[model samples]
Target: MPHIFTNRLGGVSSGAYESMNLGVNRGDDPACVRENYRRLAALLGMERGRFALASQKHTDIILRADFRHAKNDVFDPADFVADGLVTRERGLALVVFAADCVPVLLDGGEAVAAVHAGWRGTALGIAAKALRELGCAPGSVRAYIGPSIGACCFETGPEVPRAMLGLMGAEAEPFIVRSGEKYRVDLKGLNRRQLELAGVPAGSIEVSPDCTFCLHDKYWSHRYAGDARGSQCGAIVML
Candidate 1:
């Protein structure tokens, strides 16, 4: 399995997008976005045409993809809406976009999945859903929880903690902190806990220490740049 969580480096887009903007709908030039994908494909040693991207809506929807879904052009409108993509097809890359949202990559030996987990998706346990979609024993799956807004800066309203608590109960407490009238949530930790609860061994899961909000200059961060910024991606392929 080959996987990569890209940053805001090594691409052609400029302005607020700067370079390495993989998002096609972020108002970046289509030509530049395509060239970015070319650079990414070259780095991965995979064809650009074999990439299948997710139309993320912050939902828990996971779609099983194949060669038929591959598209070389990022401008192509995604026919399906899903926050996660799973595939067993060799050479076909599964891609999920994120800025402040957590991007999770799963490798189950024969199958791989790329998931976009925002606070809503995390509360829905989208990672666990993707794991179940892999149809593999959780202990055998390897997971990577990529960069996102960390607890140090992810202050939110009560609804965020409420949703997490409703889904994970007491297990969600330690990852949350009460900050006056607001709350600070650790999305990466919550996603990791979801994977562990779904049966993935704790040692098999790797969490990135990088926080997108803190490292906004290095990675795209919605909290830092808002709609003026571009998006990065987490891609995986079974080869």
Candidate 2:
């Protein structure tokens, strides 16, 4: 996968979404976001006009975006209400943004996809939808699980684990740990399991070692930063 998983280290945003805030609809200065996107495009060796993005809704809805949507002047929420995007068009970059959610990238056989899988989307099988949209057999797809809230700091009530257990069963059990009345959830690990269950090979999955919640300075952690946070992004290219 020709992908770039970026932290909030390099950009020109200020205040809350400081430096590399990739979110355009988050009330930040559009010029700043544009500059950040420009920097990102330069790093990826792609034209900023070719970098397509979606307004991730934490749903299983998968949409295909190209340079057209990438250059749309409007930032309406409906313009890109997709959790996952798949494309076979080379030079068009697919981007997925997240603060605490898992940003998954999968590419194989001239097709690639970027997915935003929060807990709700995970329960709803967004990753599986991405695989299907990419038009690749699950076994042939290589997945990259990007930085997200990790087990180290993802303390949640039993309801979280219950939803996961109900959605994934014992296959996801090992990633959930019991801690008194709370559960320490390994969302990335469980999402990897979700990919596996969807037929993606376990050996083909690569996970980022950094955890958003634990590495808050390096990432934007909604759980740790509340409403005032930036975003990290997962960008993939199809070759």
Candidate 3:
């Protein structure tokens, strides 16, 4: 399995998008976004037409994809909406886009998955769902949690912490920090905990040290750049 977590680098988009904007609907020029996809696929040594692009919606839905879902055009409408995509097909890439949201890659030998986890998707356990659907046992799977808004930059009202606590209970305490009237939740830690709860080995999960918000220049951060930002994508292919 070969996987990549991209940042905002190496492409033709301009302005707030700058370069390397992989997202199709973030107001970047359609042709530029399409070219960016081609460039990405070329770097991965695969045809851009063979990639299965995820239509994310902050849901736990993990769709199983193969050549049946492949398309050359990244801007084309998707037949399905899912936050995660799993596949066993070799040379077929699965991609999920994100700005500040988490991008996770799971390698389970026969199958691999690309997951986008915003707070809602994380709470819904999209990572665990991908593993379960791929028939991958937790211990056998290796996970890479990509850059996103870290706890230090993720300040929210009580509702966000309450939701996290609802899913993780007291186990979510350390990741949730009380900062005056707001709470800063470590989404990466919480997502890892959820994966562990679903049986993924804690030792097998690797969390990115970079935070999108903290390193806003290196990566795109929705919190830092709202709707005017471009998005980075996490992609995986079974070789």
Candidate 4:
């Protein structure tokens, strides 16, 4: 499995999307977004047309992708709306975009998956669902939880914690802490726990310590830059 979590560096987009902006519908120049994909394809030794991007909408939907889903350019409209993509086809790269949301990559030996886990998606158990979609023994799967908003900066009202608690019960308590009038939720930790609970070994899951909101200069952060920001992606291909 070949995988990468892109950052805000190394592209041609300018202004708020300066440099590597992989998101196509984020108000970024379409030409610049295409060039960013080109650069990424070159770096990964993959064909630009072999990439299958998820039309993420913070849902738990997972799609099994193949060459038919590949797009020749970033401007092409996605045929499906899913927050996660799983594929056993070699050379058909699966990609999921994220700013302050968690991007998870799974390598299940014969298959691979790319998942975008926003708070809503996490509550819907998108990570575990993606793992189940892999159709492999969980212990045999290796996962990477990419950079997102950390607990230190993810201040939210009661709704977020309530949603997590309803899904994870007592298991979600440790990751959600009181923050004066609000709460700080650890989305990465929750996603990791979901993977582990689904049978993936804790040691097999590598969690990135980088917080998108904290390292906004290196990665895109929706909370930090709002709607004007670009999005990075987590891409995987079984080759």
Candidate 5:
């Protein structure tokens, strides 16, 4: 799989989204965001302006990448809230922004995906959907689970873990840690399980040891700085 993760460490965005913010339509200056994309492109060793982006909406919507839709230029900044992005073409970079949510990158022989999975998306099995759209059986797919809110920091009420349990039943146990009145949710673990459910081998999955909530200097944590903070991103490309 295409290895990728971008924090607040690189870029030109100022104020909340700070520098290197790849979120195009988040009200940051268009030129600054473009420059940030340029930096990310350099980091990924590709053309500075040729990255395929997605419009995320916290749902399980995933689009297939082929000849026509697989343009190598990133210019569509109208509505970026699609939750997941998948592609089977080389040189077309794919990305998804996540502050408190998770960035799951899946890849194999021909297809790749970068997905934004919040509690809602995880409950809806967005990763599984992306795997299906990638047209690769789960066994061959390699998944890189990028940094986000970890279990120690992601304390949620019953609703979040409930949805996970509702969908995954007993499979959600190992990922959810109960803590008296609250629950410590392991999004990475849950997503790993989802990828496993979709057929990705457990050994092929790699979860980031970084936790955004504890490492503000290394990442953008919405829970750390509230709405004034910038965002982080996960990007992948076919090679």
Candidate 6:
């Protein structure tokens, strides 16, 4: 299986969506976005039709995908509104899009999942949900937390940290840093903790050091670029 977290390089989109913008609704031309997807599909050595996408509303919904859900178009409405997708079916690639939010990839050898974990999704424990849907023990899953808005740049109000506390109690404390009246939430660490709590071995997870907000040149950041940004997608295919 091949898995990759895309950046903002390559492709035909121009202006705010300078190049390689995979998002279909961020004001980028639909033709360009489709072309970008074709490029990504080419790199994966699969046709665009093999990709199964998540609708991504920041919910914990994990859809089980197969050939029926596969689409060649990224702009088409998904059959389900989900933040995570899992499958044991080979030849179907799972993809989820994000700008500043975290993209987590999970592989259990026999199955694979792709998740979109923003603060809301994280609070909802989307990571664990994906693992559970794979029908695999957490300890056997290998997780990779992709580039996202790091805690250093994710300043938030009480609601974000409070949601985490409500879900994880004191276990979420270390990942939430308070400075003045605001909080800095570490989305990556919070997701990792949720995976660990679900029984995933700490050593089985890998976290990317790249921060989307800090490295806006290489990645798109909704926090840094607002709604006029392209999206980065994390995709995984079962071999």
The C-alpha stretches of model 4 lying farther than 4 A from their native spots are 47-49
Alpha carbon deviation, residue 238, candidate 1 (Å): 1.0
After superposition, which runs of candidate 5 have C-alpha atoms over 4 Å from their true positions?
A: 66-75, 79-81
The predicted structure with the larger TM-score, 1 or 4, is 1
lDDT for model 2, on a 0 to 1 scale? 0.84
Candidate 6: residue pairs that collide = none
Q: Any runs in candidate 3 off by more than 4 Å, and if so which?
A: 47-49
TM, every model: 0.98, 0.93, 0.96, 0.97, 0.92, 0.96
- RMSD of each candidate relative to the true structure: 0.9, 1.8, 1.3, 1.0, 2.1, 1.3
lDDT of 6 by residue, 1-239 (tens): 68889999988899999898988768889999888888888877775438888888879989988888888567777667889999989889888899999999999999999999999999999898898898887888899999999999999999999999999999999999998999999999999999999999999999998999999999999989998888889999976
Which is the winner by TM-score between candidate 2 and candidate 5? 2
Expressed as tens digits, the lDDT of each residue in 96-187 for candidate 1 is 99998999999999899999999999999999999999988899999999989999999999999999999999999999999999999999
Question: Which ten residues in a row are the worst by lDDT in model 2?
Answer: 71-80
Q: Which stretches of candidate 6 lie over 4 Å from their true place?
A: 47-49
For model 4, name the residue pairs that clash: none
True-vs-predicted CA distance for residue 155, candidate 6, Å: 0.4
Per-model lDDT? 0.92, 0.84, 0.87, 0.93, 0.82, 0.90
Best model number under TM-score: 1
Ranking by lDDT: 4, 1, 6, 3, 2, 5
Question: What lDDT score is found at residue 58 in candidate 6?
Answer: 79
Per-residue CA lDDT of model 5 for 52-146, tens digit only, reads 66677888888765445543345564343467888777877787888879999988778888899999999999988888888877789899999
Give the per-residue Cα lDDT of candidate 5 at 95.
Answer: 76
Q: Give me candidate 1's TM-score against the actual structure.
A: 0.98
For candidate 5, give the lDDT.
Answer: 0.82
- Displacement of residue 108 (Cα, Å) in model 2 is 1.8
